[model samples]
Target: MTERRPRKDAVRNRMAVLAAADALFNRRESPEDLTMADIAAAAGVGKATLFRAFGDRTGLLRALYEARLEPTMDAVKAGPPPLGPTTPPLARIPALLDALLCFKLDNRRLALALEGTAGAGPYRAANYERWHSLLKVMLEQIPGMADSDFIAHALLAATRADLVEHLAGQERVPPERMRTQLAAFTARVLGTRPTPGSNAED
Candidate 1:
């Protein structure tokens, strides 16, 4: 069976919505501050078009979040070490954590909004599930790493968007410092210190 492609205008509308949403998120302090109507107006589209393109606020957020996270996800999935699968578990784990931290930090408001949205809680969110599953699989490969499931959850907790926002926005922690602290925390959890120059660049 053949599937029909979206009309060109549909594709253009989706892109415009995403771009407008991205801009809104960047300019606003809270994702809750922006609404579908605002995005629709910004994109020069009708509110009905926004809903048709994204289904709901949560859907729009997920679309924008995925669009922003795509590059990093691509590297983790297939690019070279240390984010790539071919890297040793010990190296790759920290690299992955670092990448996730940087991603949340870079997309602070959007991440916070998406993860906080109704029907998209952290446990059930697609992005969180993917990271947790990958981290669990990697942890399982390491000898003596007990309770990979819990460990992955615990490790990811440190990178939660709200926590990142607190440290970055309230405590004024520099990005490098946050990255260092997270690396140290990951090492302690893994019972190993990072090798020199082993931390992946943000």
Candidate 2:
């Protein structure tokens, strides 16, 4: 039997739900403040429809997060240097961490909500494993880098959503400054000297 496609109306409703949820999540300080009912209302669909489209609140959040991450993930996978396959591992390592940090900063509340969910933290997420594996492979390519697996995990820890929130929200560190600090710290971890005039020190 041929696979049945989703109805056109179902596709439209799904898009509406995602767009509404994206807007609400972006405007709110915390995703915990929003609900499936709220999303359904915002999307002009029944709560049942929302649940049917996405199994639950966690599922919805995962879909939204994945949608937002897709472009960046694609770039990292196949785009130009610094994030693509062509960049030297040493350069790519720091670049990847920086990209992750920026992504966390941009999606602070959503990242926190998703990563802090019950029964499944950030480490359990598929994207987290993908990033860890990528970082580990790159670290392995660098001369004298030991324990690439542990090092990759350690490096990623610096960009955790909660940590980014703590530094950006509570501490009020400027975005550029936070990036600089992370770069400096990453350089130290890799035992590489920072580039001259690089804000890694600032």
Candidate 3:
């Protein structure tokens, strides 16, 4: 016997819940301020449906975060040069790090909430592993680059949501300056001088 698929309305309701949660997350001062009930009401679904769909707040946050990151992840996986597999390692490494930094910067609040969720270390996250694996592979291709695993972790550390929040929020660093700084930093880790004018401050 064939198994039944989710009904069309069920799929639509799921999408609505995710969309409502996304909007609520962006509008609220903090994700902690939003509740499952609030999301259900906004999505026009019942509280039971929300809980059944996502399991819990952390699960919901993870789903929403992943949804938002899907586009960039797709680019890194199979899109154009600099991010895709076709790009040279030396160039791709910095591009990957820069992309991650920009992503965290753009999704500051959501990232902070997702990473800060109880029992959810970014290192253990599925998306984090995908990025680390890709970076490690790229680093291994570069000449004289030892400890690619550790190096990948270190580079990802620089783009952590809390660190990005500190620099962009409390320190008031401009987005362009932040990107340039990360580019320069990545270049240093890869033992290459950033191209002239890439550092923004140069």
What TM-score goes with each of the models?
0.94, 0.92, 0.93
**Candidate achieving the largest lDDT:** 1
lDDT of 3 by residue, 1-202 (tens): 9999999988999999999998998899987899999999999999998888889988898899899899888988899987887989888887778888888998999998888874555776657888889889888999889999999999999998889999999999999899888888888788887645676343
lDDT of 1 at 133: 91
Q: Rate the local accuracy (lDDT) of all candidates.
A: 0.90, 0.89, 0.87
Two-way lDDT contest, 2 vs 3, winner: 2
Worst 10 residues of 3 by lDDT: 193-202
Task: Give the Cα-based TM-score of candidate 1 against the true structure.
Answer: 0.94
**What is the TM-score of candidate 2?**
0.92
lDDT of 3: 0.87
List all candidate RMSDs to the true structure: 2.6, 1.8, 1.8
Alpha carbon deviation, residue 41, candidate 1 (Å):
0.9
Better of 2 and 3 by TM-score: 3
Cand. 3 TM to true fold = 0.93
Please give, for residues 1-202, the per-residue lDDT of candidate 1 as tens digits.
8999999999999999999999989999778989899999999999999998889999999999999999999999999998997999999999999999999999998888888874545777768889999999999999988999999999999999889999999999999889988988888899889646646232
lDDT of 2 at 48: 96
Q: Model 1: clashing residue pairs?
A: none
lDDT of 2 by residue, 1-202 (tens): 9999999999999999999999999888779999999999999999999999999998998889999999889989998987999998878888888889899998999999988873556898657899999999998889888999999989999998889989999999999888888889988998876544557782
